[model samples]
Target: MEKFRIPAMRYRGLVEALQAEEIDFIDEAKEFYPLELVPSLEMTPYPHQSEALVAWKLAGRQGVVVLPTAAGKTYLAQMAIQSTPRTTLIVVPTLDLMHQWYAHLVAAFPDAEVGLLGGGSRDQTPILVATYDSAAIHAEALGNKYALLIFDECHHLPTDFNRVIAEYAIAPYRLGLSATPERTDGKHADLNILIGREVYRKRAEDLAGKALAEHEIVQIKVKLSQLERERYNQLIQTRNDFLKQNRISLGSLQGWQMFVQMSARSQAGRRAMLAHREAKEIALGTDGKLRILVDLLAEHFPARILIFTADNATVYRISQELLIPAITHQTPVKERHEILTKFKEGKYNTLVASNVLNEGVDVPAASIAIILSGTGSTREYIQRLGRVLRKGNVENKQAILYEVIAEDTTEERTSARRRGDNSPQEEKHKSGKLKVIYGTGKKQDLKAAEQLEINYSTQNKDVTNGVTDSSPKRRRNHPQET
Candidate 1:
């Protein structure tokens, strides 16, 4: 029979199809080489990791592994690399992760050549760790260079551009890893075709107290001031009136899409949109929430803490008010790295960030997480909770995630939805891991409020961002500020 060629992605399937038809051919597509690799250090695999590795091998070394963050997914990838022992390429979603994987691989396999392909550094080594952007741009040149492809945070692989990195690859063995694989846009469905079906899975709750630290979720509801409540109601009513007149429902995805499309075309729609945002801002950034945060910070003094907010404005506000280091998309890389390193070394005891630390970035272990505000996405919730779930140096450490919700507002519904509960009226709901604390954000008596003092870190320059902590010994009688 005459010989013909196929696309690099189709090479594996075409070979199988031809073999089924009793066709013989000599194909020349793969350009990867086998490596003689041995790990320099000795480590034992956790039970879940071992089981996951076995499942992947049973599935022909191609599939996704769904393990929660802090469950050591990176170490599992290292184990897979050792078992397969091929010229491998590990693709990560961020430059930070690429450097992390590059460091781990280099240390684990000292004899094998490990290189990085992102962050302006391109090295042609047998084992390469690349960012998604870099790999997708050089997909054609890298199509046949690797025999195995391991995608870290594989949930990001299904994008229109990133999928080509997998499609143009001639690698037969593939593995995908992620804490949360489901996407809001429904692009995750393509992962089954790009990498393979999910072969092993484990949730944060499933691995709690074993592979991860035992954790508790505490939801605190705070009331807005009387004036703030009145304003919030007015804004929400204005938005709802428009929604009712247009017969638009924000409960459904299509309804929200229609509202967005209509909001851009007319004056009434724009006002309605503005009203909705203003109402949400009032609920999410209430002063009562800040009061509770001051109390929490004083209560958990000197313990490593992470504060999350929905917007950069809130992040900066909290950072300035509490004298904690802040990280956001606008933060410079060098400054962000310095802040994280100081936090890890215990020089800075607390950090406040927007959504920048939710994924891809490696955060140090913390016993407490205070979420000032967030959207109704379970993925984001899980990622934030995972930040404090890593097993720390303390014995029997209990990680606590405090979700401060604005009472009698839309945020309550959002909190319920994120916790997989649709009914917000159920004040005391216990769904597996999360427990609600009713009315914890109520204003404290004046005497108690006056007694509240924040004991910041003694190393004033570390967290204050160049502001001298004159009263570092004790900040007493700190008035509640709006």
Candidate 2:
């Protein structure tokens, strides 16, 4: 008989299949290492955290733990390290997160040598933290060195290329952590094969008043200027003409991509594609949104606020116009670090960012989050909301998120779709026929709703609350919450 090895992620399936055929195989991927656990700090896990640890251990030390951003996921990871004392490698998505993990690990185990393999540093020790890019580059060489593999923001692991790190590593103990594990392309299903099943999960609402800060989502409707509105309508008409003539449904799964490919074949198609982009830009970056933003900043003065935009151009424009520090992919590592440090120190009250801060970056919690614009992805919305949902000093300070939407455009549809609810108001919003309709979560004041051209019948309900439950649920074999 020949001896063969398989990835630990597939251990359960392979073992079950082998046992069905009456084949005997030895399991040795998790050989114990002579690693010492030096207690550097004393910290206690939350009740749900302790439950998560129990669920992970019950799953054979291999599974993903889904928790909200500020619900102490890092502490749970540290607890995992202490429970299973071994050479461990923690992989994070960005250098900022890598450094954050490194510092936390160092404080958790002061005597243990903590190494970093990203941001031009290449130190290897019992507890090592590396960025996803660096880990992918050196996965083969460091495959067999560690007994535990921890993936922070582990939802990124299922990508075609990033999966190599997990596949190449022989570590038998694996833990994946993320606030939201669902992906637009549905590759999150591959996470079950890459790491393990999601063993524990807690949503934003599940821990709202307890673990996470109590929060409220506010939706503001704004109108474009006449000139901008004219241009936007023209561009939208141009794109719609092409779609209607070609019988292309932009709502299909591969519709946008197919449109891109077909649009490049001729001048008309190219014009249509350009019109689509310009129309989107005009809708998302309308002058009205900026005016409202200025008002919001003034209203929330002295409160730390995070401004999220759909693109870097808008980010820079907001940064320049408002004089707030901006961090994008183009920002240097050192500059990003300094900006975050200053923000944490309360020197900078407001920060504007594109998509770079959406995941895994240890951003200092802010009291307010203003989303000027974003994609239709629920994950993006949740991550942006999470940036401000961390517990704050004021016990009753309701973390507020304002989703600014352009009235009477595809943006309204995008906002409704991302909210994952198909109420009558959403149907009306998707029809691209509605004017501004603003309502607080409280009982709708008919006079106020009518004054703003709102549909009281639909506006009475809270669409923002629906956003909190939009995230896809993970099926767990064991009870998720204790």
- Best lDDT goes to which candidate? 1
- Best-performing candidate as measured by TM-score: 1
Q: What TM-score quantifies how close candidate 1 is to the native fold?
A: 0.86
Instruction: Note the Cα lDDT for every prediction shown.
Output: 0.80, 0.76
Task: Name the 10 consecutive residues with the lowest summed lDDT in model 1.
Answer: 461-470
* Residue 167 shift from truth in candidate 2, angstroms: 1.9
Whole-model alpha-carbon lDDT for candidate 1: 0.80
**Residue 242 of model 2: what lDDT?**
93
Cα misplacement distance, residue 207 of candidate 1 (Å): 1.1
* Per-model TM-score versus the true fold: 0.86, 0.82
Separately for all candidates shown, the number of backbone clashes (residues 3 or more apart, or on different chains) is: 0, 0
Which run of 10 residues does model 2 get worst, by summed lDDT?
465-474
Off by over 4 Å in 1: 1-3, 16-24, 425-482
Record all residue pairs in model 2 with backbone atoms less than 3 Å apart, i.e. clashing: none
